[model samples]
Target chain A: MRLITLPILMLSMFSVSTFAEEHVVSQKNKSFSENKISINVGDTVHFLNKDPFFHNIFSLSDEQYFDLGSYPKDESRSVVFDTPGEIEVECAIHSKMFLLIEVKKSEDN
Target chain B: MKTLLFYFTLLVSQLSYAAETEPTDYTFIAGHPSLQQWLLPTPIPTPKDNPLTAEKVSLGKMLFFDPRLSGDNNMSCATCHNPMLGWSDNLTVARGYKSKALTRATPLIINLAYNNLQMWDGRIKTLEEQALAPMEAELEMHADLSQKIALLSGIDGYVTAFDNAFPDQGVNTKTMAMAIASFERTLISNNSRFDTWVKGDKSALTADEISGFKLFVDPVKGNCAVCHSPPNFTDDGFHNIGLASFGHDNPDLGRYNQRRLNLMKGAFKTPTLRDIALSAPFFHDGSAQTLSDVVEHYSEGGKVKTNLSPNFTANTLTPEEIASIVSFLNALTSPHKPFTLPTLPQ
Candidate 1:
């Protein structure tokens, strides 16, 4: 019973190592699903436009900067947080739509 | 097998009952509970740093109407934001310092207290930041900041008013901006025929006006309610609603100047539609001459469609329907109040 449990734990650890963290932030009703989120460096955050209208995602942050141009409903864009810092994400069209992302250093690094 | 059949029968009956309860008439649409979201909030939201006070309001009112705040000492904020003309100058485009014709129209100061951003392009984030802009701008008031502050500091009447408004802070740019913003916060409009109708008065709107409202909300119809939302009638969002001026050689970049995004190239902040009828020659460029002209432009899905907002579409509204929408817009104006001009301090 001990041998079987040890192998199961090792396999789960391997699986976790192979997959990088990915988060989905949906835009609906001119707002983000989450106002803020935390993730490790190299983790990807996907912005999904769920509203009928177009939404543009961009960040003029210190560590990471990106401008995902406007896209219509059902479309999505992803950005990888390369640095460990706070990034303010906002929709260009809708000024009120704002999200803050806290990126931490990867433990493996 | 017998239990399965019984459950299926129950489900079918429930579905039919639900179908029966679904809204099917105009009465249900007109009196929907969701309509209550359109009511304006009271007691007005103010920043914690600059809470509203009678002293601040009075001081701000004097500064707003005082021409001595300018470089030439002839033009005040009231020169362009005339209270009689919907708090705007009612010009095709604003006349700035030395009677220079500006590129944009003088936007009404009405209900600006509720706005998240200021100016047509939304460059300024707060009213405090906005109050000092025209005075400092070369084309507007053209006042030197230090000189203006010095002038205010020397005046005993202004110094006393500033002391009363800011208490410990005394006379300075920051306190002056806060006081002006506090006064501007008082400029709000919550009373209108449409407001009364929203507040449970069935007789407030005519049948034609009600139909126009339906058209305004309908996705396939006028679709005005998409941007001009409830209460304040502004979504506080920016859009490049294709205007004819956008086709010009050197068209204004608007929000693009601030954000540097292609989508925001010609985008301008969506202004409040409350009392919109009074502030005519609409659009950021002051292109449309009248309200009908504005409706007509939207009906065409915008003449210059390049880079047009995805939200806009060719509205298939008839002449009568257009007139009805105009009639509904007319009901947005609140009853006028006799505005007494503030006495300038010597």
Candidate 2:
């Protein structure tokens, strides 16, 4: 019974790792491609710049605050969602660009 | 003779139609399709809640020009944003309440309708949000809102004007801001020679001006368009374009006060270059004296490089290139139309 329980616990832990997903959000024409996106906790969001110029994506939100600095065209910056809450993201360079990220708890959790 | 005149009119109409139907895909300079982005959009953007009306504009103009709204019953918005002086005071730094010089230059009110953000720090999001800021600021107009409201409500002319403008809204700060914003929306500057050139008038700009324009867009050359983008000539972005002022102790942290980001420190909103030739003594600190001086600053890649904007890079533009760029900037000036002053309410 103990051996069976250990195998079941290992399978559950492996499933969580396997299920973690990555989402792509593009910055084009000084605006974020997605106005709002929903992602589960442990998921990663990749911010890709498609514009000719640079973009500095940052979020001052209490839930996962980050400043990606500035990256040029074709470059990408990523952030992993560890907390479950709404995050408001914006470009430091262009105030017009905004992205709202909704991080939800993983189904297993 | 009648037949000839009719044929001439028909021919002119056909030519106009042809010009209008011409594909926008055609490039201004060879290999630069991005130049088409320089055309300004028509019908200025306004909040749906506060649509522009003649009555509103009239009321706003009165409020804007009326000095009675100030704490001292003196110094109207026009005192700093004077129309004769390019909608700016032409002062190095703006003089606030009681003739105290403020830290930053009084930003021009030109083409503000297109901006999604307002003020040097972009602390405000709309012109309506920006209108009452000076009137309330301790160092600016410094008007006691309660007293000002009482005074305006007392005036029969103002009461009638406000009623005409806002109907059921009544005399209040919101309506005043909305009215002032409505008037400011009319301050559009999109008819410059460069605009004419963008509209396909090849003859509008001279050879030197065209060359200067090419240099302005060339990433390795002028690279001005990277920040001072198309149409309104602003990217609606903020940059810490390393001015000597940044080197000063306790330098103005500009956008950082609102944004609280390390990059935002010393960053300020990128001002429009539409009527660049008009407003002199440029930059937030009013550092540069002339267009040439402005170009020189960029050529040196800003004075203080410690926290320079990532977008800025030292360029190697020659004197000729600089002159041409300045000439191109001069082409951005729209012909000044005579402004009719609004009659103040007694």
Over A52-86, each residue of candidate 1 has an lDDT whose tens digit, in order, gives 56788999887888999887765567787889999
Model 2: CAPRI class: incorrect
Off by over 4 Å in 2: A1-16, B1-26, B29-34
Weakest 10 consecutive residues, lDDT, candidate 1 chain B?
A: B17-26
Compose the digit string of candidate 1's lDDT tens values, residues B146-225: 99889889989999999988888988899989999999999888888888887778888898888877777666788887
Whole-model lDDT for model 1 versus the true structure? 0.81
Residue-wise lDDT of candidate 2 within B1-346, one digit each (tens)? 4333333433343234323322222355522455667878878888899999999999999999999889898989999999888899899999989999999998888999999799999999989889999999999999998899889999999999999998998999999999999999999999888888876777889999988988887778998888988778888999999899999999999999998888889999999998878888899999998999999899988988887778887798899999999999999999989888988877
- Count clashing residue pairs per candidate: 0, 0
Cα lDDT tens digits, model 2, A1-109, are 3345335433533443445675678787788989999989888777877666778999999988999998876566779899999999999989999999989887634
TM-score of chain A, model 2? 0.81
